[model samples]
Target chain A: MTAAGFPIVRAPAASATDVRIDPALVRRWLVTFLREEMIVRRGMRTAVVGVSGGVDSALVAFLCAEALGPANVYGVRMPYRTSAEESFRHAGLVQEITKIHDVVVDITAAVDGYLRYEPDASPTRRGNVMARQRMIVLFDLSAKYGGLPVGTGNKSERLLGYFTWHADDSPPINPLGDLFKTQVWQLARHVGVPREIVEKPATADLIRGQTDEEDLGITYERADRILSLMLRGYGQAAIAACGFRRRDVRLVWDRVNATHWKRHLPTTAVVSPTAINEFYLRPVDY
Target chain B: MRGAKSRPQPSSLLGLVPRRTSLDATGPSVELAVVQCAPRKGDVAANLRRIEEAFAALRHDRSPFPDVVIFPEASLSGYFVEGATVEVARRAETVVDELARSARRACGRKVGPFDVVVGFYEEQDGQYYNSALYASLGRRPVLRHVHRKLFLPTYGIFDEERFVSRGTSIEAFDVPYGRAAILICEDACHSLAVTIAALRGAQVLYVPSASPGRGMEDVEPANVRLWRDVLRVAAAEHGIFVVYAGLVGFEGGKGMSGASRVIGPFGDLRAEAPFEGATILRVRIDLGDVRVARAALPALGDLEANLGQLSSMLARTSGQSVPAVGARAARRR
Candidate 1:
């Protein structure tokens, strides 16, 4: 039940077309976006993607390979000790198919190096540490490899605040940032990502058995529809009329409302009217 | 009465513009070039260099460019420079002089009796405006007209209203061949600007836009699709040629898809540029088509004839006091 006094009754699932996209158009746009943002705008000819065997990163790898040929893309596979072996295999699948510059830098020692000091740290903290440590490796490699660090988080995870804040969304440019997870899967299929990787349950691979759906308590398919509708200014009553489960709507809405800060730059106290990003803005270079 | 006889003609008496009645019955043909550009953000000098290169290329190949050349809105500065617009803003007079000089230098000779409509952030009387300048560049250059954008879109990725002051006028200016009007970006979305230009006997409407392409659900970018619809409708309804020039390249991840095109008098796609990058969409437009189309429909003619009556009805509908010229308008029609 929602805090707004709605029932928790289950409803029929929405048609996939609710989050469907024209894959050809989307692929072209993303390729253009990647080239413009990374190469044309910043003079970075290459890109390094932190491929985690998930659909999102794999899709980004495929796009980067297409944008700046396969040779220019470095697909770095980062696995902690607890990460599933399937993660490494899937990341390998992406590298094999795209023929991207394959690289594997296991982050176990780096994550464990920090966590050994805090033995009683919670799983969430430990996962965050792993995520941050992977970012450190990817960024350092970006310098060594002479490539931009491509972001792989989709709009659904961004809205749900599913990924670590700075560590996951910290890349300078993202081709998939605006696309919802369902749409990302659609684009993934169009761009020829492996069927197994496309069909697999999405996971961060920070824990052994953790899946994103299980952690979020809702399917990405449902959450995306709700998030898209909510952002389009549909109220609770309007959304409920669209045949969404009240419980799912509540979960998606709460997460989106709660994690709004994760999507933004740190808010600074405005002592002057001309505060940057508040009153002052230079849109292109931001 | 605000009928055809009482219609406003701002420059008719000055003899700067030939009145509509005096124009040849068989209107002239104009070769138009809509140049899609990816202007560097906050760097007016770099963008100017690009503009100069475009002119150089055009003049080098064809000599005297074309009858009309249109660039995208904020061609002098990229679209989303919110506060940086103040730094890039130029006075209209200064811009025309500089543009003329650049064209002459690039062409290595006196270049245009041609019209060039270029959009820029403008500063006049200590006020800033998003403006499009229509000028005839040659040995004797004339600042034909400057259309300061009237409707500044403030919501949804646009903060134009906050950065620039709104323009209050929408009038067609006389080109060497015929009358034409400029509508910068958001101004084209509002039908009133087009209607005013149509009433003033404009045969061509130039829309310079820097609108970011949005949505992935369709085969084409959503904004591009919508702009096509609007451009088509505006062209066909008013029996005018609609030339749209769009910005290409991404601005902070917002891709401005360059789908610039020319919509004919019959609401058909005359010529279209590619969506990916900078390219010129060149097409020869016969102004005679305007007369043929308007003759076929006569919608603009009927509206101009009965405007005084419609104004009173509109006032009544909006709960305002009605004006007194209904009988005269009906009789005039």
Candidate 2:
């Protein structure tokens, strides 16, 4: 029961796994948020999105086109030399469907330029360099094209810290930040995203044969269920008791706790009486 | 010859017809539902789509469906929208007609020759009203009642007066189940509106509101407690059921109070929805409960008898000449 004495009925476990969302409600919410937070509040007329041919970025592009017309939306596809041909093809599909202005930036030179500094850089370092390089291109185009860069990170990836920090997570505004990966897939289907892109294996497309589940060691379906339980205030023991493997539960819990710092602004040592983000606080709009 | 007189013994005896002991107990009961929804600010089309979805969900239930479904204040266009021009205000009749058609089509023969009451900003004759429409849905649709907001609250975060016109009168009208009346958000705060409704023979009083919840930690939001007290007292005092359907959402930094509920005529809490989410609360009520409560305490009868005297006193207090009893009665009729 809630504090107000109303019974708290949890969504059925099966339903939670399949997460029913009212697409119209979500569409209206995103449209209103963009109108208020971007155009009306921040005085921005155009939006720039980095479309990677995955469900998350595809969903973001569709939402931006819906909120601001296709003429005002700019889709940037940044591909490295080793990037999959399917990635470029799906990105083109998004551009065709949304009819938004599109640009292709080849980042192989920039990435290889940095890789020359350390020939033995690990795969993780190389992936990070690619992610950061793509962001650099997106941000630069945003400035040159006079648009604000919008993010495409979903909640599951964010909670699991699957993306490179300060690279994919640095966009000024994001419409997909709160939707889970599974929910994003549902919304993608509802908003007319191509079936091929929605059904493809989730990946960052940095390596030749990398899948998100293989890298994270947990399928998105299981990860989303566990994350939903944790969000509803279930403790580690309680979640395991609900028929989940204890190891997986602990893994998700540890990841969420470890990545807490990535969700907040940098900590500043307080020197004066009222320091930034301490006593001298201001609202986001302010 | 002497008497002639028993003045033709009175044709009929006074008070011979037995006073109705429990009219509500004899009549059919009604299943009522209140939908506490989070409306998208200034998005009428989306909000209407959501309301239709709720009705569709109710249609699938095998149990007895609600005879009347109530949505929160401004459920069509949202509340606190002072920035919306008159162009955004919807015509109440057109919206209600469309909703009735949809409801009939969705429910089919499974349910609802029922009525739906929803709030919206009503536009008519170059003026706008914060209004609630009582629409009846069957094979065809009928506009039963339209209650504009009587009290336009303008304190603190409320700027209703700046956006819409105030309603002119308070009266109860007949519905399929029984007599009922409607009061918009701030109107529920005024006791006189409830009294007038009950005095005018309302068995059910519907208070649809968009009151924002405000309070500190560990304490109930003030509007929740206030509306509860109002509904309870009005129900118990006048023996009329009270339904409060409050909107739930954060609009421009203001969070609405979402504790929509139904109070029985005896002041019993029937059902209450949550304070933060979108929910449909259902409760079955016998209009006979009103008769049961009224029988226990004959307040309505007493008030009806004393109204003429009160009117006279009011006239005197306001320094106006009192009309002849016949003329006053004629005017009332």
Candidate 1 chain B lowest-lDDT run of ten:
B1-10
Angstrom error at residue A222, model 1: 1.0
Every model's TM-score on chain B: 0.87, 0.87
- Measured against the true structure, the TM-scores of the candidates, in listed sequence, are 0.91, 0.52
True-structure Cα RMSD, model 2: 17.3
Off by over 4 Å in 1: A1-17, A284-286, B1-25, B62-64, B110-112, B317-319, B322-333
Clashing pairs in 1: none
- Candidate 2 regions exceeding 4 Å error are A1-18, B1-333
What digit string (tens of lDDT, one per residue) describes model 2 on residues B228-304? 87777777777788899988766654557778888767666667776655778877777877776677766666766
Q: For residues A1-286, write the lDDT of model 2, one tens digit per residue.
A: 8889999888755543344466755665566566555775567878888888888888888988988899999998888898999999899899999999888888999999989998899988999999998889889988898889989999899999898889999997777777788878878998899999999999999888999999988888888889988987889888887788998998899999999888877878899987865655433333
Q: What is the fnat of model 1 with respect to the true interface contacts?
A: 0.93
